[model samples]
Target: MKQKLIFFIAIAICFSSCENKEKNQSVILKGSIQNSNDSVLIFYYSDKSDTVFLSGKNDFRFVLDLKMPVYGYFRINKKTINVFLSPGDSLELKADANRLEEITFSGIGADENKCLSQLSEERTKQEINYEEWFSLDEKQFVFKSDSAYKAQLIFLENLQHKFNNLNPFFTKTEKARIFYTYAESRIAYERSQVFSANSKQKLSPAFYSFQKEINLNDSTMVFIPEYQIFLKTYLDKKVYEQEKNYETMNDLIGAEFDIILSEIKQQQIKNYLLHSVFRDHLQFNGLEGAKDLLALYEKHTTNKKNKDEISSLVKKWQQLLPGNSAPEIALQDELGKIHSLKDFKGKYVFIDFWATWCYPCRREIPHLAKLHKEYSGKNIVFISISIDKQKEAWEQMLKIEKMPWLQLHTTPDAKLLQDYQIYSIPRFVLIDKEGKIVNAQAPAPSEKKLRDMLDMAL
Candidate 1:
């Protein structure tokens, strides 16, 4: 009797384990790619992202725990494939790295994915020729957009019909995407007419009838890429309607933020716009006058993620501010000799961050050469740091150009680039004689402002 009872308890425990395992099964996105050169694939969903590293054999997988179905996209290098993921989905994908457009799906969610692929391809075929569309009059533009919208909507409906088991969330969001895309084009047309062409002819009331359909306060649609774009265009239209004259770019940004705070009531939309405005400001002007605006942003926005990101950027920018000691830069020369910025401490330093592959950087070469020749006798040193991954290309270019300034090579991921916040090529920096930063984002070698700044510093 004791042995039988123990056996019964073991069977009950096994059953319980099986039940828990079934309940805990989340989304399993596994894939294999042939001839893939990338190290990782990025999957983005609902403002969150997950990365799966490719194995030695180029197989990858991501197990995601999701509460509801969401429309997301997988990005490998420059190629993006849309996907619909739901709880309990166990989807598998197969693709050739060279031909990502031909990716195939299997297992659960296969029908919806195949349909999405068709939808993407069809939409591409129906994409508007913006140049041609812009040349048309308001009436013609509206007619063209309306026709396109109708065709796309029909295509989506057909996809839903074909894929009988399509997720409702995916269907709803796809429909929203089609509509928002049309609305964005309409807004773009209106802006072109009013601002670019300066057209005074009153447009027909029917032209803007679509605006009535736009719910500016809707927070549920924030994750849709099309809706996000439409919101931006809509915000620009609202801001431009109020005032167009601004002395500076930051002034324009400030006006945008004011409109966002005062007009937008939805918490999510308001937070998104606020974060966007501040980020743009930071990108363009770097941390100048950003503290006050940041304080206001912290006061208004409840999004801890965006707030933390902005705060982190602010701290990084603080290190690059004028009068602060310049970030240490150590790079190797053509002969593999390490050169430090501190080696030229007694002289003012003008750095030109360039690459052999950058057309704009090459274009500035002659202008930089002229400055170097002119300032050869001055208390300053001109240095060209080549941010090229292939050292051979940089060395070959150096041999061809025979640039007179100190030629150095550094990889793209160097600490020097991050420390100085060098996002783009052909960047210039000016350092004082005492190793202090005069301007982290100094004027270019071709600019008269650079000459003036140098003269004043000397």
Candidate 2:
């Protein structure tokens, strides 16, 4: 009897120890890759929170300490491999070591397989739609050729929606990344056709819209090499120079330049490139070469008469940089009560420049509301300035959203717009307690980025 009792106690202890060990253990991912050398595979988490690097081996095993289930992208140079994992799960994966031609993942209730299958279906649909659109005869126009541009815009919009829906389902970044490549390829193919100067005028808007769609769909982290190549090929020097519409041309040039500059690291390389492009090629010298053009303008262009005008405009652009002083503006609130920068001297101020018609601006309301609630009575002031032409829309939106922050609007004055260089909507400025600009393109208050800034400021 004594021996039996001792045996029972030992068994209980062993079971309890196993349970505790399992609770503490990390999810194990075991895999093998064939025929690859010195190639690195990087795993990017879905939240963009962390990255893991793995080397190709005959057999590879990785243990991940997961706090929760996650979707991650695996990449070998430019090629992506996507996988899904759950906490306390184990996976066994196999892949072609030579060319990354085939990958097999088994584990965690076939989550990875399900994600890949969905991605495959979406890709097939995208290919079919693209092929069908491109195959259509250019001469066949339901409306005037210029009018048909709208049809292409509609098609691109639909494509964007489809891609957005499909992207989240992809467990691997590679599969999700192919959408941008397809967009680039389609745009490049379309741009290659030589049309009469007159016909090209009609097609230009469509081409621009296509490029915009590609940019809008692109994930900030996922750098598509094909898109970069397409931009370089289609958007040449002459395209930037010959375009007369400064606003649209500036956008195109800036977007393309930003794409290129994002890849380059050395400050000298960037300054040299900017000088060659802006000063030498485009003949645009103002705010061209400086790392923070707005600041350079503010410091150098100060003549008292032009101080208010040029300083404000330069400060606006400066605010676009990460750490810059917020542009100072005195405006009246909805009740016609005047408020100035000095009033919010000792608190962190987030000034959002927006309009009622702007969809992106409106989308930020929920996020702002949540932040306001979370940081209620904190040392932060959230203010929104509307550049809307109609006060009715702004007023109506304020009422509908029940916004608690200080809401102000300016009439449609060219001077005010020019003064602030207000060329874009949904811009935000963050000001610290010292009334200095903390961030110019300070993201909307709803973003975790804003929360982080608040944490630091407070």
Candidate 3:
């Protein structure tokens, strides 16, 4: 009797274990790539990244624990596959490695993914060229933008209804995704119309109705790319609308803070915008009148982590203040000539860290040329280092532009990056003739103060 009872207990325990295992099974994302064998593949979303090696037949697979629906990036070398993912999805794909964009999906969420694919195809075919868009009248522009947004909204509504039974949460997130995109279209339409209108043809009241619908404090949408962009657009518009209220730049910054604190109710969103504004102000203008802003952030924000992170950045910026020895950089010139920061020791170096793809960086090139010409015989050197991954493209651009300053290229990830904490590009660093950093975070070539600083350095 004792042995039989022990056997029954063992079976019950085994059954319980099996049930738990079945319940814990994750969302599976597996696929195979045809043509060209690449050893490594990468999958990324938001702040998370995962890397895996390919099989002999270019087959790849990923098992993920997903709590909510989101977009993810699947990459094979330089090629990328954008995908929509959700729980209980056993997603499968067979794609051509050379044409990563063209893919077919199968399994649980196959139908929804197909809809996304259709939209992607539509976007590629329907996107208006920049010059073509600018040529359109305000009415035409508004119609085009509105139509695009409306069509996407209709599609999203139908999709949500179809998938509502599967997961209401998933459908809601999908709606948010589409809504994020709609925000971009809305902003673009209004901006184009506003730019063309004369003083008497004031429009904002007509085209900006959608702005009132958005919840400024919704941090839940932070993970969406379009949502992040929308926040930037919204905040920028707020600054422009209230520009007349503030007289000086410092006053403007203070007003921006007040607006954010008053309008944004979520701690996370406030913390993000506060940290962003503070960091950017520090980056461009240095620490002048910024201590007050930092104190304001500390007083208003309740997020400990965000406060700590900004505090750390504040300390780092302090270290990068004027008169500090510039971080050492080693790079090669266009003709396979190796050089170091020390090579330009005798002359004042107007060090510009830029990339070919950056529009602001390209815009500053003309200013740099003008400055170089003006100070041609002076004791200064204008050196631009490109952080471009493609050497051929960089060379082509330089040849096409005929830049009059020293041009050099470095790999995308370099030691120079770590030493300088250079987060954004088109950054200018003014190093003294004695090889010491005069302004570690110097003004841009286009800034009027840049010339004054350079004159003082010389």
Candidate 4:
């Protein structure tokens, strides 16, 4: 009896200790930020649902209570510090009074010191290269020997390789180095390739190859200055003429005239291409689209006959904004019930353009479901139209998510996408009772802007 009692007590004690350990293993993130103004420190978990926000202050400290290891950002103004935190580990982030190099966690760690030393060395080398390239006199280069240009090419190549290798190990200083190196190298390469090209085809391929090599998407976050420099250099070289005086020019001019004209046409094409690429980047960053291209079109194109063509593109974009009348859509619901814009005309309607393959759109379904439940009795209709090419995937998502709103799919012809001008998904349009555009390019109802607009409209 005594042995059995002792055994039972031991078991109970072990159970209690296990429970305590489980409770104590929560992830804790603690940090201090200094000299921050209106900066929000946001931490987003990998699971994507959990997020915590901390407001910045003159001397700010915060402790985030989390359940597991996560990756998060500490944003101060426009600058951000990204870190990975594990459970039960205490992290101390100390930002400087000036908000630069304050130090993270403890004293004189070997890895930290090594990183700082390497970053310093890289920055110094990059500064030397920048001075050498930028200080070169363009007039001297006009009559210079090919040897000088060749040497510049060698220097740029070596610097570019060094920057690429150091990029993975980059601190903020190293990031600056990489940006400058890329700018100098790209400018040098563009000058050489453009001046040396024998034909229009060759020039196009060279430019395309250079763009592909730089991999613009990789540089999206930290290469803004470099990108601007590249664009300037490219445009300058694009306008360079083979002959100083076209009146006296003969063989070279005649041979290159067609090529030059073709190049001009190609430039127009490239302008649109680059604008589209930049627009995509802005969208990814959740920024308002740049109107620079529209301004350029208005400035240069003088053909009043093409007004309809231009207006169509602009109108499509306008319809994408908030409170815009949902485009006239025709699709079949889950039960093969035919629905149209007119069917839900009496009430406010949310036409959500989405697809099963879109991760963001998939993540938003639960939020939509909640909204559907909340506004079920109200004179509001939520309709999700999937543009998935495959009906199987659409049906699968509908079943898995158990979405409460009307689910519909268009035929694989993609007519609906074309009609709606939907180049991207997770887009929503809110139509008011009268069907006139209230907010075009409106975000989905899950966002605060949409909610506010809906409240007003209702």
Q: Candidate 1: minimum summed lDDT over ten consecutive residues — where? A: 193-202
TM-score of each: 0.83, 0.38, 0.75, 0.40
- Over 1-458, each residue of candidate 4 has an lDDT whose tens digit, in order, gives 99999999999999999887765555445556666565445554432324344454434444545554444555566565555444444555666536555455532122333344344344444443433443344433222323333444454455546544322323332343354445445466446544543413233333333244443223222223344454435444444544444442232223333333344343333343344333443333222333543454445444443334455666555655555555677779878889887887788877788888898988888778878887789998888888887888888877788887788897545766655566677877677775655654566656877777777878
Each candidate: how many clashes?
A: 0, 4, 0, 12
Summarize candidate 2's per-residue lDDT along 1-458 as a digit string, tens digits: 99999999999999999886666456777777665453444466633434334543466666777765555656554456656666666778787755554677676535545445455445544443433444444533212333434433444445445444333333234432454454455454455443223334234454444445444324332233433444455445334445445554345545545544565454333433333333322222223334343343234332343335444444445444445455567888888898888999899888888888889988988888788788889998888889888888888888888888899888667455544455577777778887786765576766788788788778
lDDT per residue as tens, model 1, 28-138: 999898776688888899778999888988899989988777778876666777888888888899998689888999999898889888988988899878878877888
Q: So what's the TM-score on candidate 4?
A: 0.40
Return the candidate ranking by lDDT, descending. 1, 3, 2, 4
Q: lDDT values of the candidates?
A: 0.86, 0.57, 0.75, 0.54
**Top candidate when judged by lDDT against the true structure:** 1
Q: Show model 4 residue runs off by greater than 4 Å.
A: 1-293, 300-311, 318-326, 411-413
Q: Give the higher-lDDT candidate: 3 or 4.
A: 3
lDDT of 3 by residue, 1-458 (tens): 99999999999999999776664556778888887456877788644677777798888888877656667877565666777777668889889977867788998777767766766666566564655654566566567767876787677666656644545554565566566666666666456555655423445466666666687777667666667777777777777777476655667778789888888888777877777777677655556568888889789877676677777777777766767777777777878888787888899988898898999999999999999998899999988989898998888898888987888888778877656667788788888877777877688888899989878766
TM-score order of candidates, best first?
1, 3, 4, 2
* lDDT of candidate model 2 versus the reference: 0.57
Report the candidate with higher TM-score, 1 versus 2: 1
